[model samples]
Target: MKYAILTADEPFISLAELKSLLNNENNIYYFSGIAVFSGDYKNIARRSSNIKAIGEVLAISNDPKDINEVIRGKCFTIKPNVILRSDKDRFNALYSTATKGVIFSKKCETLDLIFTDGIIIAGLREEERDSKSLLLHAKKPYSQSGTMDAYTSRLMVNLANPKKTVFDPFVGVGSILIESAWIGYTCLGADIDINMLEKTKYNLKYFGYTCDLLQSNIATNCIKKTDAIVTDPPYGKSVNAKTIKIEELYEKLFSISSEILSKNGRLVFATDAKYDWRDKIKEYNLSIIGIHFIYLHKSLSRAIYVVQKR
Candidate 1:
C-alpha cells in the first residue's frame, strides 16, 4: 500500500489532483489531509505540488503499542497528525525506547503517523515536495498582477494528467506552460495578444524551457490534437479578460477544447466560481472528474475543473 500526505489548505483540490494523476490506482481510503491506497505510484511525490509526501505504508493499527514493534531498530523520527496531539508524549516515549538512532539526527527517516477516521496509518517517507521551489514564482522574469504562483500552476498542470503534449489556449504569461514544459511535455500555447505571447516566450526562455507559441485567439484558432489542455483563461481585467465577456470566453474554450483534445485526454482549467459550467461541460461531451474551489479573498474565489473526454 502507498500513502500520500496532502496539502492542508486545499485538501480537496489536492485529492482531485492525485486522483486525476493516478487514475489507474485503487484508492482504499482518503480524508482531508491523507490518502492510503494501493498502486504503482513511483515519483508521484515529485510530480505533485499538493502532495507533501508520498511513501510506502509501513503499518496500520488501532493500538499505539504496535508502533514500538514497527520502529524497532529503525533510525527514524515520528511525525503525528494534529489529532494525535494528546498522545504525543506516549509516542515519544515509545520512539525513544525502540529507535536505534538519535531523534532529529542525520540519516534518520521521517515516519508519518496519522490518525484519521478511527484508524492509525504509519507511512515511512520516501519523497517530499521541494517547498523552497515555490518561491520561484517571485523569481520568474515576467509576471503580471494575476500570475498564478508556481505551486498552484503546477497543481493545475498535474490535474490535466498530461502524457505528451499540453496545450494552453489562454496562455497568460505562460504559468501553465512553464510547469508543463518543466515536466518534459511538448507544450503548445496560444493567445489573442501578441504581447502576452512574447512575455510567455521570454519567461519560458528564462527557465531554459521551450514551447510552441501562437498569436491566435482561442475562439477561432484550431490547434492540433493534444494529449491534455491545462490553462487559466482570462478573468475580468484589462490585463486578463481582453475584449470578450468572461462567459462567452468560457463557452468558446469548451467548444475548442472538445474539438482539440484527443480521446481520453483531460482538460483542466480554472475560472470564476460565479458562473455555472456544468451544462456547458455536458454539452461538450466531457465527463466531469472533479471540481475544487479556492477562495482568494472576501470578494474572489477560483474554481478549478478537471474533466475527461466521454
Candidate 2:
C-alpha cells in the first residue's frame, strides 16, 4: 500500500531510522514539533518520486484539549486511513462516518500517525502496559534515551530480517536484545560496564527474557559470528567513561567490530561524535550502506551508521 511514515523534529536521524524501517518506495514525512505542513516533508516527497506529501501536523501531547484542537477542525473525508497514538499522548480517539460512527482507544500513546482516504488507519504507540510483548523493549536500558519507544522498535524489528543470531555489543540496558529475543531470534548482549550489564540483566529478567548476557569490552571481546549487529553506543557525554576520549573509543570499536563481525553481516549503530566513521569503516573493509543523522536533544545530533562486511 502507498503510505508514509511520519517522524518528529530533528528528523534527520528519525528519518534515517524510518527509512531503514520502511525500506521501500513509500513516502517519508518529517516535521518540527508536530505540524501538518513543513518544508522537509515536501522535500521528502519530491526527492522520492514514490512518495506523496500531505501536511497535517500533530504533536505528542497528553492534554485532551490540545489533541482535540489538533484534530477538531482538521478535515477528514473518510475518517482516516489510520490514527497512530504515541506514548507521550494517550488520548486516542478516531471517528469515521463511513464506519458507522466507530471509535477506537488504543492502549499506548501514539508517536507516528498514518492516514489515508481522510481516515486514520495506523497509529504507533508506546508499549508500556505489555511492553514485553513489543520487540523493541528487548535489550534497551531503562534510561530515557537509550531505549526506543515500543512503536519504533517494533517497526524496526519487523523490518529487519535476522537469518542467524543477532548480537548487540553495546547493549546498554538490553532493550534491543530483548526486542530481538521477543521476535524469536537467539540474541546476545555485551557491555563493558559491570553495573550496566547488571542493569541489563535485571531489566531483561524483569521483562522475562532469557537471552545471553556477557560482560566484555567491545574492543577486545570474543564475539560469535552473527547475522547482524545493532547497537546504540555511548554518546561519550554522559554514559561513557569520563577518562576515555571519543576518538579512541571509535577506533577501538572499529578494530573490534571488524574482527568479530561475520562476512555479509550488517552493523548498525548511532553515535553523536562527528568523527569520520566512514574512513574507519573503509579501513576495516566494511561497505557503507547508509548513514543517518538523528537529533536527540536540542544540540546533540547523532549519526547512525549502517555498514556491512566487505
lDDT per residue (tens digit) for residues 231-270 in model 2: 7777655555667766777777777667777776677777
Q: Each prediction's Cα lDDT score? A: 0.79, 0.54
Measured by lDDT, the strongest candidate is 1
- Model 1, 253-294: lDDT tens digits are 888878889998988988878867998888998988878888
lDDT of 2 at 69: 49
Candidate 1: regions farther than 4 A off: 83-105, 238-242
Poorest stretch of ten by lDDT in candidate 1 = 93-102
TM-scores of all candidate predictions against the true structure: 0.90, 0.59
Q: Would you give me the overall lDDT of model 2?
A: 0.54
TM-score of 1: 0.90
Error of model 1, residue 104, in angstroms:
7.1
